[model samples]
Target: MAEISAVKEAWEIRQRFKPEIWFSAPGAKHYENRYYANHHHSFVNISVTGEACACRCDHCNGKLLQSMVGTPTPLEMRRVVDQLLDKDCRGILVSGGANSQGEVPLLAFMDSIAYASQKGLKVLVHSGIISRETALGLKAAGVDQVLLDVIGDQDTIHQVYHLNQRPEDYLRAMLFCREADLNIAPHVVIGLHYGQIRGEMKALEMIREAWPETIVLVILTPSCGTAMEGLQPPNLADVGEVIAKARLTNPNIPITLGCARPSGQYKRQVEILAVDCGVNGMAYPDEETVIYARSKGLQTMFTEECCSLIARNV
Candidate 1:
């Protein structure tokens, strides 16, 4: 493992890390796909309104949002949840683009989720950036889990999100959720600085200030029609380094590799590194990582459900 002290070190690590990154390839497919089948799952989203996002960040510009069934209104969301239950869908993760204030209008869907909960549909939510009032409302709605991005640098905050708020605001939001007793999963994106682990470690340090049950680490992938198209992903070892750090820091809490991690060898590498670092579970993991975990004497499983399930086991 390297110190990850400079971009030069990251570049050097990237070239050397590729060979070792292949460790995740063993658990390639089918063997563990069922782990998420009957147990935990999430509906892929498409579209970018009501239940979709508007801000569409550079790494993902709402293209992923298109997979979710359209729910443009509260009642519409209720109908969709009903349909989901009829289809035997596990539950739903409600998210959308940010409003002008950089917050998702989650209050609109809270009551509707309460109704869905009655039908045995668990609800996990992604509130891009939030205020205290909304956090309280989500807790009152009986929401299952809440995920928020915790940023460390004000520069990445303003440049990437195009919103100006101190790191304290995000800290406040996470603390608020804890106060309301909401199951919180804070996210830290690696290589947000054009393919380097700049703000990620800082995010972990910041999260240590609060009480999120779990923290999901995902690497940024450059998407077309955006500012970061074609930029390489962060080194796999860098991803592992952070995961190992998070594991050592909170030994008891669950750390997950979220759905948006980089694709191809980088993706496989991430899965393998997760095992070495003692990751409890993974979301949509590449086949290789699963195989590697088994070889290393770890029990492997996959889930389409949100990473918060990791909290329950920990």
Candidate 2:
């Protein structure tokens, strides 16, 4: 009952403002919104590590990498970029598994990222906890955007990601990105603690301090081959509360629901809540979500691109 009240309060608060609904699902995602829309052949995700991951975090255990295009080396990444360009792809998300220390080995690909940017492809990187030097290097390389997952609870970091770093370390990383003048996006996973809500609002408060160009909210979606396969998923109402708090905290910043989250009926409910909470955008939304948003007289648009690109687009 408390959860329902919170959801209703947030929904009412959000309806007082005009909201925009964005649908970004790259690589052949097709949907209809007054017209047939598809995102395939325009945007793609590339795994810089192929299938290799060191940390093998409890939630993922590297299973997420299987969905990305594997590009294990700088040359391979560049080659893949060429193929994507040939297909007239608009952008690419360069991501990979992190090392044991929660760092993705992205330094080696700096030159390739610069090359891709020079070739007119929008490049975004999922760089984990990185050094100041790396942040500056990414800025110099002209990478379009950088995504850092911010965790507010130390236990969540240590137990879930198995990292020795503290929550302050994540804040410091965001500071480095800001110092480097890079377009940075901070992602807060709503239910990262084994499908339980933990410190998510605190994470948002921390991001408010940094004032990033954009913020992304993604929920924990347990994969079948991972340790958390049978774990209970996050509650839709709780996820809605986080989104509402984020809206209250950073009214001017673009808030988006990223491509990762629970699916089926849960996804529909959560997406609807996100819209009601005044989120700026959503990634890979269902057809019904678009219809719902339209029914509420909200502005809606679709792109065959990444949700992070919403910052650049706006």
- Model-by-model lDDT, in order? 0.67, 0.83
**Candidate 2 residue lDDT tens string, 7-51:** 556556555445556678777354545543675678788888998
How many clashes (backbone N, Cα, C below 3 Å) per candidate? Answer: 25, 2
TM-score of model 1 (CA atoms): 0.84
Q: Whole-model lDDT, candidate 2?
A: 0.83
TM-score of 2: 0.93
Give TM per candidate: 0.84, 0.93
Worst 10 residues of 2 by lDDT: 28-37
lDDT of 1 at 85: 73
lDDT of 1 by residue, 164-239 (tens): 7767778888888888888889988887877777777778887888867887877787667677888888776676
**What is the number of residue pairs that collide in model 2?**
2
